[model samples]
Target: MDRAFRWAFIGTGTLAKKVAREITASERHVIATAYSRNREKLCAYCEPYNAYPAISIEDAIDRSDVDAVYINVTNESHYEVCRQALELGKHVLLEKPFTMNASDTEKLQNLAKSRGLYLAEAMWTWFADVPLQVRAFVQSGKLGRIREVYMSYCAYSIGYAPRVSDPLLGGGALLDIGIYPITYAYRLFGFPLSITCNGDIKNGIDYGEHIVLGYDGFDVKMDVSIVDTKGEAMIIEGENGFLANPGYHYGESAVAKTKSGVDIFKGQRSYLKEFDSVADEIRQGKTESSFIPPQATLDCMRILDECRRQMNLVYPFE
Candidate 1:
């Protein structure tokens, strides 16, 4: 009910630090506390924001001044930490790979609903403006009926070495990076009727994957890889023409072409605009976030769950 929500960040890592920087730069929210098991890391992460670093996770959640908690920990830790925050009656914003599977995502959603608290998956890409524009183009009949979508997200992260290969940590191209392309497709087209995925696994974790999602009237083909670099774009094909996004993750611009001609749309970092939605949701005590709702997260998890099942892939936590 406060005019500006007080936020506690659960992980003092690189992503958490970036969120803190953005929160500091914004007026809608303030970083009141931060926590990590390591005191030094906690301090280093909170220094720029001038936030109080909690000695324990419980202390961070139990702080009366904190209105929301941002869970930016590892994939396996998302459910536990967010559960703790929601149990403490604090709204939660979780980093993606919301859970190791759909069951945990369902549990979190049920808990938040019962507690009258807001729980959002921080899939910032969904909140980006390019997708909204693309949606409008589809609905406007500018591209006619959407027939197919193609998305690819790939990058070389060999410098991380063992971390990239570690199965226990839930490390893989799919969960780590593929979620983007999959979620992008889902956001535009909804859950597919069926999915077939093939991946190359090294040390029991998928290093790269190619997924084919089939819908009633359309299909989606997506590829994600951590072993190599890709063009990293999304193409939404309609009956008439298609909309092409050169950079799907944080699309700086998009080009829409139809039987008529071509139209280009440009913008700044899409993630920043997405962050504003979070701020508005928390500040207003809104139960639902229009950006990425709980059901959408659940749907995404179900698709990932099916993909994992078909590929015979299981995370350590599962």
Candidate 2:
């Protein structure tokens, strides 16, 4: 309602801290307060932004000064936390992998729609400039009728960290890291008609997975691993030429090559771009983002659900 949105964060973890820093640094938004179970840790994280730390989640959500709530909790707790925020009539910007499955995502979407509240999944990559440029190029027919997409995101966690190996915390490559490549493909090509998955599992959780997603005219082959390292790149092939990003997943640039030669496209971090979208949605009093709609989030969840089912990976919460 005001020129700047008053924001509160639900988790004071590393990601939350980073976002808090961004929000505080920006003039368009202000950090009103932050909520975390660990008061000491929350205070420490909020100190840089001079944000007051709420003693509990309820206090944070119910604060009259707070205009929106950012849900940055663990994977298993995202749904519940977001539900509470929505119930409190606070707009929410949820972290990626919105939920463990489509059913929960649908429930949240429906709830937000019913409450006339704005709810968004923080898929920051979708708001990036390079992706937008790539999409524009594709739409312009430069890359004729996209033929294939290949992506790989992996890191060796042989030492078996709790977050990477634990089943109780919704640990796995698919939910944790694989969702990036999956979402990237979905953003470019939409949900595939069919998907096949092969995974390495330990203690009933997926450590690594190779997923092949099939569409009518194109195919997406993606690999995500916790026990191995991948090149962390994305390749898009079309009938005419192709676009390749050596550091595709989190890079600042990409290269497009055809029969002629190579053309480089440079970009900067676009995470803050999504904040403008969020601000516009709030200003318009819209319940959903036009750029990253609820249906897209639901589709992503469905794909992840199917991938996990095929891999026989199950989290304790599920």
Q: Count the backbone clashes (under 3 Å) in each candidate.
A: 0, 0
Best by TM-score: 1
Q: Against the correct fold, how does model 2 do in TM-score?
A: 0.93
lDDT tens per residue, model 1, 1-318: 536667898987777767666756766677889898899888887787778989888888898888788898877788899889888888888989999899999999999999999889998877777667766666688888778888888888745745456787677888888888888777777888889999887778887889999987888999888888875988889888989987877755899889999988766664456666786776777877888878888998998888888778887666
* Residues forming the 10-long window of minimal summed lDDT in candidate 2: 157-166
Clashes of 2: 0
In candidate 1, which residue ranges exceed 4 Å CA deviation? 1-3, 158-164
Position 153, candidate 2: lDDT: 86
Give stretches of model 2 more than 4 Å off: 157-161, 259-263
List lDDT for all candidates, in order: 0.81, 0.82
Clashing pairs in 1: none
The TM-scores of all predictions, comma-separated, are 0.94, 0.93
